[model samples]
Target: MFFEILKNLRKKFKRLYITMFKNYIIFVFLMLLVLSGTIGFMIFSIGKMVSSEDYIKDTQKFFMASKIVKSDYKKIDASKIVASKGWVEILNSNKKVIYVIGTKKDKVTSYTENELLNFMDLSYNNLKSGTSYFYSVTAFNSNGEDLYCIVKVPPGIVTLNVDIAPSPDKYIKKAAIYILVGIFIIIVFLTVSVFLYAYLTTKKVVMPLKKILQGIKRMTEEDYSTRINFNAENKFGEIRDAFNFMAEKIEASIFERNRMENLKQQLLSDISHDLKTPLTSIMGYSKALNDGVVENDKKIKQYLNIIYNKSKRTVSLIENLHEFTKLDNSKFLISKEECDFCEFVREIVSEYYNEFEEKNFELEINLPEDEIIYEFDKVEMERAISNIISNILKYNEVGTKAKIELTYDNSKIQLIIADDGVGIDESLKENIFEPFVRGDKSRYTKGGTGLGLSIANKIVQKHGGTLTLEKCKKYKTVFRLKL
Candidate 1:
């Protein structure tokens, strides 16, 4: 059950609505917002506590103002002996009420001096119930007589003892409004700061995602060359690098595929053109012989020879085509083994000695005497070597000297084949190793198929080696093989 839960968690994380980085930014912002709101409430609560204290002090001050009246209570005007939204009453030491002002005076006038004194000694709630008002008491001397003064404070203003001042309602309201505005401004400033931070931070995180989307769009349009050229200092940078690498690989793959397709079409066209001439001669001469159109024995023999030669050429062409196809398809594996490189070459060279003699060619062997053992596919390597020798035999004139030189470096085996033949033309040098590409236009009928160099090059490449036409001067041709 735990494993299942963990698996679900992993899946959720993989397909998360918000990335980890962006989610983290949002979480932090929410925390900051909560903190800002809490601080604002705290400030407002402190302001209210201070305001409540000021209200109690103001009530004490109103009590003091009421005591300032004389013992007779006639020196102060009844109208002036009042507070804003409050009333005042004075009593002599004899417990006789002096006067009452503001609000309903009947509640204060009914309270006996002893009764009010007892109420003042009780809790504030009892004091309000006895007088039916919220008021304060103070003792003072007027006309040399001790007196008790009661002053009623309005609900809107806090009772402060500092002075018999105006009602605090307007000032308190204004202060409360100012505090509220301050809290609102602080909240707005913090909100804007958090939102701005989130926007910039999220943009930084999501920028790479946008680039990835753009890259994918370009790829869908078959533009493999599109690459994200960003070097960021984060995990997204690794993603960008991987994306560029993939684009390069895909581009290379497409290029190679297109090149192979073109090669296939060219191969088909060349085959058709090459086969037509030989097939025509074979059919024509065979038809003549079957119709008894050639009466004499000598003429019939000549016709038969012509047909046989054409058939042989056609068969050779078909075999070469099949071999070329097998090599291109990447299905054939090289049978590799360890052997002495020098001995292998000597054996293949000895087989070609008779051909060299028949062509009136001089054979030269320049090989290092070192016994160099190398791993290679002997059959394929020999076939490649034979193709090169066959070209020498077919293209070079009589009395042309052919040289086979073998040498080695620390990392490779080098085979150099040079011949004083009718060398390749400069125009053909660029595409000398392409199939069915012949030089001078004369080698087509000189018993050459024009695929010799191409096949040899492919074979050598499969052995993890390279073969190239090193030089093709006027009468000098050199092909270099490296393994």
Candidate 2:
């Protein structure tokens, strides 16, 4: 259970953990290097100090003198007793110096018991001689005779009153071996620790990098939907978010390109179908006249009229197609002029009044009394409005009611054209403004180019306005134009 909790915590803060762990490993390695160097330096310095010839010789001399005094004081050699600038003295049981060697600067040859005891008890600084000496005293019995041998050396030459090994070379070799072993152990431990640390840190970094590389590879294979799901608190997190955003944008772009390609193909198919129907009719009627198939004068005239009407319809379809293409051009611009929109709408309605009357269609006009002034291209705006009214007349019965309403505010003007007739098919509602989309199969039979609403929409858009089909409570079909 405890291990599971730790694992969860590690996963949650993996980035921070990796960063800190890397730093810790570096710190530990440096500290180990410094520690090892320090230990080696200290050991080397101590060995240099203890293994010096002067110090080793001093220890050897002291130990030799001690052995001689303990075995037999009479066997002491005066020449071997003193160091280079030091001296030796032998005193009888009466506390009087009986023998002396080397440079004895002190004048006192006889001593009181107290003076003798002082010399043996302390390292004495003799003022008259102006020399400081370290003293070592060895008391011995030679054939029941009591004697004291004092080995004195200047403080700089030797050390006294401390235990030392007799063979300095052997002692130094042993100590060096121990130090080398310790250093070797430390180096091995640090080496193992460093390898472990490097392995763990590399794993942490490489795993995320591998995931990113895989995502990039998939994207290279044309998978625009590829995305990375890296969870981290560092630069990797930013990379993940950027990758996902780019993928989303690329996916949307590809989808839009495909949709436009499909629409282009559909447009070509619709155009060919609409053009061929009329062309075929005109050819049939003309061929009949050329072959003399209709002999009656009236019938011949009717056939000629049919041919002319079919040819006119084909020309109209071609003209509508050209107008739509012109509006779609990027460089197309509309000439705008300030005019009374209310009056303008009334004028457009009046032109359609005679047609509506001839068709016996009910017409309702609701125009504001106030003059709503606006800037627009008069020719283009008129054509857009006429297209809507014409569409209403083309698809509705003779007694159908048609209404035009105009409203405006300080910011915008809205024009609505509505009719009580057969409403648009539900399936066509979404793309009603798209080119070549018609109400139903009856549209092809009714002789429409299917570009009326599309042309109107483009014209309105070119004038910086919007044309949309909207729902209304009182009308079955409603077209709203906002400028």
- Name the top lDDT candidate: 2
Tens-digit lDDT track of model 1 for 150-179? 766553444323243446675567667767
Candidate 2 structure lDDT: 0.77
TM-score, per-candidate, Cα-based: 0.57, 0.56
Cα deviation of 221, candidate 2, in Å: 1.9
Q: In candidate 1, where is summed lDDT lowest over 10 consecutive residues?
A: 155-164
lDDT (0 to 1) per candidate: 0.74, 0.77
Candidate 1 deviant stretches above 4 angstroms: 1-204, 357-364, 398-402, 420-422, 425-431, 472-477
Model 2 lDDT per residue over 79-147, tens place: 544545666677788867877667886776776777657765653333223446556666766668787
Clash-forming residue pairs, model 2:
none
